[model samples]
Each structure stands twice: as C-alpha cells, then as structure tokens.
Target: MAALACSPADLLPLLGGNATSAAAEYICGRFDAVSSKFVDTGYAVDNTYLLFSTYLVFSMQIGFAMLCAGSVRAKNTMNIMLTNVLDAATGSFFYYLFGFALAFGTPSNGFIGQHFFGLSKFPSQSFDYGFFLFQWAFAIAAAGITSGSIAERTQFGAYLIYSSFLTGLVYPIASHWFWSADGWASPARADNLLFGSGVIDFAGSGVVHMVGGIAGLWGALIEGPRIGRFDHSGKPVTLRGHSATLVVLGTFLLWFGWYGFNPGSFLNILKAYGVSGSYYGQWSAIGRTAVTTTLAGSTAALTTLFGKRVLVGHWNVTDVCNGLLGGFAAITAGCAVVDPWAAILCGFVAAWVLIGFNKLAEKLKYDDPLEAAQLHGGCGAWGLLFTGLFAKQAYVNEVYPGVENRPYGLFMGGGGGLLAAQVVQILVVAAWTSVTMGTLFFILHKMKLLRISHEEEVAGMDLTSHGGLAYEFEAEEKKEISF
Candidate 1:
C-alpha cells in the first residue's frame, strides 16, 4: 500500500464538530501506525527486487567465463577462465573499497564522487546494500570484456594490474560522469543539463560497454596480435575456439541475464505512474523495457544469420552469436525509452555495425579473439547513437522525471540536442579510455609485463603459466589393469 499523505489536523474536517480530542488522537495514532507499515512494506519490496536483480547480474560472470573459455584456443582455456573468475573476485574488493565512493558518493563535485569511502555510514536513507551489490556486478562485467581481447597471450600479472585499475578508477570515473545524479551529463541532474539534454545512456552503453571495448582495443593493439594470427604476407589466420557449444551456451546465458541488466537499471519497481492504484506504472515500463531488449537481440541474431550466410557463403553459429550480442549492447542504452519497433531497427543496424567493424579489423590486421572490441566497442557506440535517434518523448519523461521538455531522440522530433550529447559521450568515453588504458598497456609493454614471451605464446599460457593444459587425455598403462 502507498503511504497516506494525511495528518490528524487534515482529518478533523471528516469528524463531526462534537468529536472529542481523545477520539481525534486515537484516530491519528491509528493512521500513523498504518502509514508506517505501508512505508516499511515499500522498502521491503524494493530491496527484495534489487537483490534478485543483483543475483541475475552476477550470474553474467559465469556466462562470461564460459564464453571466454569457448572463444579461445584450448591451450589458453584455463588462462582465460581464471581471468574471468578474478574479474568478479578482485572487482568486488576494489569496488567496495573505493569504486562505489568515486561513482556515487554525493555532496561532491560533478566530476567525481567523494563520499561513502569504505561504505562509512552505509545503508543510509539514500543508499543501501542492495544498490552497492548491483553496481559491483556491473563493474566486474567491464573487466570481463577487456579480458577477452587480450586473451591467449597476455601475462597473468598484467591482467591483475589492469583489472584493478579499471574497476577501481577508470570505470568508476566514467560511470560517475553519466550515471551519478550529480554528473554533468546525467539526465537525473537537477540543473544545467548537457546541451539542455543529458546523454541518455540508460544502461551504460558508453560507460560500461564502450569503456571496456576501448580499453580492450588498446590492450590488444599494444600487445600485438597473437603468434600465428597473421602470415608473413599479412594474410589473416583463423584461430577458432575449441568448442562452439560453449559459445552458444554462454550467449543464451548472457541473454537471460540482460533482463536484469536493462530492466534492473530502474533500481526500484514499486513506483506508480500517477496514482497508487493505477494499473500502469513503473512495472509496466519495466515490462516494456524487457520486450524491447528481446526484440533487439532477436532481430540482430536473424539479421546476422542471413548477413553472414551471404558474406561467407555459410551459416556460422559463432558469427550469429556475436551479432546477437552486438544487438543487445546497442539496444541497452535505449531499451527503456524506445518503442519495440525502434528496438528492431537498432538491432538490425547493430548487426551490420558489428560486421563492418569486423571487416575493418581484419583489413587492419587487428585480432580480437572474441571480437570484444568490435562487438562491444563498435556496437556500443551505435547503441548510444540509436538512443539519440529513437528515444520517445513520453517514455523519456517517465524514466527521468522532474525534467520538463527535455530533448529526446532527434529523429523522434525532439531535436538534435540529445543526439549531440550522445555524440559527445562517444567521443569523451573513447578519449578517456584510450588515454588511461592505452597508457597502462604501453607502460606494461615497455616493462615486459603485458605480453608473454614468444615461447609462452607458442606453447600457450595454460601450460606455461597455469600449471597444465585445460584438458589432458592419455592412454592408461597396462599396469593400471592391476587396479
């Protein structure tokens, strides 16, 4: 039940003139008790919803592990899987230590947050434990994306250094710039919005996806391609993963987790659209967001299916899987505010965008084993652009309330202000990630900590660094028959 907005004095008119003070006091006390219960119930519901969403988001880590394992050579399978696991573990400690503060601590400057260090005075009226857990899940996901790009040849020590830096500093700063209420580009900002329309990255298309992708781009570039990635004549070589089944499984898992990724961004579900008893409210919006997310991914998968068939003269499940992910990444930014039909367009364009980026990477001899840079970075940029072009005015108002006449999608008749802001987001995210992560990779390269030795690369990091190969099959000796 919604909390009642009545006081004892307001209720006086309902009582007869002969009503006694004792009667009024009794009635008011009862009203207060009921209102308190309602408030408590609301909190309980919201917290429960958030906690469940956090679990869903956390499960994406497992999906990432399976995906990375299936996307790399079997020799490096253990190495890649280990990094994904650490992304969650290390990301948790660092994000709890200071990442949350840098991204959400309020009463600070717009550029960065400064409060809530180590969760001091935590579970306040404004922030709670559930919120922190949800954000932590997102932080690890960024690290997971970068791990894929530099897989197969990266040093384990290098992975630790970069993952910590990214979760604790780089990703937090970028998220603060867009997701924090006090951020300069946040639509939730109370005043002085960017271009009178803040960047509408509803679910971190730029903050998470672009940052991870760009960081991966630099890491892979600095490390150079894996051994045997290209020939002496510069012809690209195919380094297919050992298992396609794992790729399909991982893709489906990611698809399931996206329900939490996009809709869960609401942070609360008990809010009503206008009145408490109304059938339409935030719950309805959440359902719409889920629908849009599904449509975009589905459309992109089908588009890639046919598109790849034409390009390569064959139906490639791996290519389709990547295309499906590209669509999800692109639609994430606008899922809540766009119509379902618009999501289809977003997914369709995202498929081609992934294909185009893949072609460009091949031409440039840029090798990302799982296409993390091209799929996440390239398609992520397009997702932001799609939001700027398709977000609906009514939905925008509903999602980012208290902002009147805010500019929406340019193609939706709102104007170019929102689109311009999105473009700015793309540029700033690219520049920031390149400068920070690119420098880190460069230093690691110079210090001989980024890429493994050629010997390790040829033999695979699983064998050289991870104790042994991921899979070992040997014939048993005749002596085993004694057992």
Candidate 2:
C-alpha cells in the first residue's frame, strides 16, 4: 500500500503552522506544491540523474577497454576486449534478473530483503525506475573491476558464468546488507558486534569494488599468474599498459562518474528535511556532499603525484589515476557527514595508503594485474574506516538525528566505540565476501572452467573467443617516434 501524503508544500496548511511550511520549502528544494502532489515527477528527475550517472559510469567501460587492451601483451588484446564486453552484457542481464531484487527488495526485519528471483513484483508496481538505473551502473562497474584482474588467461565461458553469479548473487547480496533500507550494513541501524554499525560503505567500499577485486584475487590465485607474469623463481617481471594515455583517460572518467555515484546516494534528494526552520536540512547536506567529494578527489590526485616521486623516483600516471580513485573511495563514507577539511585528510591519507598497499600487494604476490586489489579492496576498507574517524557531530545530528545517530568517532570525542564498530564491519564484510568468492572460484577451478588454454591466451581472445581481432597491422608501421 502507498503512503498517502499532503503536498509537501501543503504540509504547513495541513498542520496549520508557518514554521513547518517554511521548513518544508527548504527541505523540498526545487520541488513545489504541485510537485509534491506528483511523487513520480521527483522520481522522474532522479531517474534522469540515474540515467546520466549510468552513462558516466558506463563510459569507464571504454576507458577500461582501452586501458586493459593497451596494458596486456598484443597477443591477448582481443581476449581483454572480449572479457570487458561480455562482462557488461552478461552482468547487466543477471543484475536485472535477480540482482536488483536481492539487493534492493523491500526490507524485511531490517536485515535481508525477501524478494525472489528478478524484479517479479516490484517493476510492475510504482517503483523507482531512476534508482534502478543508477544501481545498474554499479553492477557494471563491479563486473569491470575484475576484467583487468583476470584478463590474460580467463576462459570466456568461465567469465560468463562468473559475471552472472557476481552481478546477480554475489555483489547484489553484499550491497543489500550495506546500502539497502533493511540491509545489515544500513547506516540507520544501531551497532551490533556481529555486523558492526551496519556497514557504512556510502559508495561501495565492500559493495562494488572489493567484492569484484576480491573475486578477481581468488580467480587469479586459482588460475595462477598469467603464464609469464611471474618468472620460474617467483619474481615478478614488469608489464606495461599498451597506452599510457588510455590509463589516464580511464582514471578521469572514473573520477567524473564518482560525483554522480556519491552525491546521488540520497536518492530522493529533493524530499529530505530536518526539524522545523532548520537550515542544516536535506538539500543543504546534499550540496555539501558534492563539495566534499570533489575536494577529496583533487587532494588525492595531488598527493599521489607527490608520493610517486618519493617512492618510485618518478611520477607515474597509473599511480595518480589509482590514487584519485582510492581517495574517492576513501572519502565515500564520510562525504555526506565529514567537513571539507576532513575530506582533504581523507584524500591525502588515502593516496599514501594506496601507494603503500600497491607495494604490499606486489610483494605479497597477489598478481592483481590492475592492482584492483589495492585500489578497491585495500583502499575501500580504508574509506570505511575513514568515515568512522572523521564523521562529525553537526552533520551526524542533522542527517541521522536522535535515535538514528550512532557514537561519534574518536576525533570527534565520541571515544573508541565508533572505531571498534568500523573494525567489526571490515572483518565481517571481508570474511563473507572472501569466503563466498573463494568457494565459487574453487568450484569453477575444479570443473576446469576457469582458464583458457595456453594457445588461446597467446593468440589473443578477440580471435579465440569472439572470432576477430581488435586491431590488424597488415599495413606498414608509421614510425614517428616522439621524444
């Protein structure tokens, strides 16, 4: 049954209060009296934003396609392209079929959603179509994160199954716990030792990136490194992305898309409100969120540039790109609650942590081709923790108020409770995702559906899997070397 409401503008009239009407206007932003009567109009705008965000997020596919194709050996060029393409197609279908239902189904007991396979009942009803599209963008991004990880040797058929399971079951289920209304990870809940302060992954530290990256890690381990990525002595050899330009472009696209990803979290941005006559209400908060997100991204980019010189003796594009992503991911949790300066700290530390984790992942032999493990998994975890540390009292009070507000971070003088809550969240999400993804990999490995034959890998997936090459060098090379 739908919840009937007087026009948001008419709220004051119904309640017979001037303060309430003034508060309603402030909270409603661009929506007016007539606008309040038509809930679907607001939904329409969100849907449009959702579509625009999807377009932005999906653009990363081109960035990844270019970046991944250019990164691996030419022999595997087509293979990379095929993997990127299929993952998007198959992942979208699977997400639509059951993923949305699992992740965003109507709440049940404030834990897991109870809808069955696909969007059986909801799509036909008065559903938020815009929100659905925005979520679809996330599903695609999650699938793409693993493309770089399993690029060279993963079998096309195996990847198809992997994409389906990940988008439909794995990623969706995790996202449900963190972002959905009744999810275990919902920020609205009180802290529980078993689940932590519901999981504060504002933009999917564990939901999208880590889930995909860890799955990639498991796939990498089960399949072993690309035949030549590591030598017989177990030392890694250097491999270059075919085009540095593609990598930079991909990074920029991701950064741009993140604006939509984070600020759009308040799906019904135009409808949120605070106490009567309060200025620090819904619309005000969302505007602040946008500003903090941008600050974090820019600061992270600068810090990564500086860190590269200190650590690697040169400024590397890949480091800067991933640094920005790490910063964005790290700030995601606090974007809505932390002040602008906190975002800078979040960005700076996030870059430093990303550089450190990159080295650690390399030393540990994770064989994360895209370093997705560090960019998303390591940094994603950092983002969640950063939120616990930086979340503020004013913002927290305004957003959550009263009962919904949890303990403040240590920096905010709330004590160690918030930090401990974060730690619990990290452990549980990590364990659940890792165990589930690892088991799936093991099963696929045992069935011999994990990797391609050495010959196919060497020849390139374009020809082997998709029956064509992405590029043909039949003509003479135009050698105009740039200095």
| Model 1 / residue 426 / CA error / Å | 0.2
Question: What are the per-model numbers of colliding residue pairs?
Answer: 0, 11
* RMSD (Cα, Å) of model 2: 6.3
The TM-score of predicted model 2 comes to 0.85
- Where does candidate 1 stray beyond 4 Å? 1-6, 9-13, 474-483
Q: What TM-score does candidate 1 get on C-alpha atoms? A: 0.97
If scored against the real structure, what TM-score would every candidate get? 0.97, 0.85
Q: Candidate 1, overall lDDT?
A: 0.92
lDDT tens readout by residue for model 2, 1-483: 222443556665655654676676665554444455566675676567667766766776776677677667666777777778887899878888888888877745454566745667656453556667778778888888877787777877787887888888888877877777676657665544222244456667667777777777788878877766668787877777666776777777777777677777765454446454656456678788889888888898999998788877998887777788788877877788889999999889888888887777667666766777677777778877887887886776556544443566669875666666677667766787778878888898899888888888767667777767666653224433321
lDDT of 1 by residue, 385-429 (tens): 999999999999999989778999999999999999999999999
Model 2 worst lDDT run, 10 consecutive residues: 474-483
How far in Å is the alpha carbon of 263 misplaced in model 2? 0.6
On lDDT, the candidate that comes out on top is: 1
Cα lDDT of all candidates, in order? 0.92, 0.73
Prediction RMSDs, each to the true structure: 2.0, 6.3
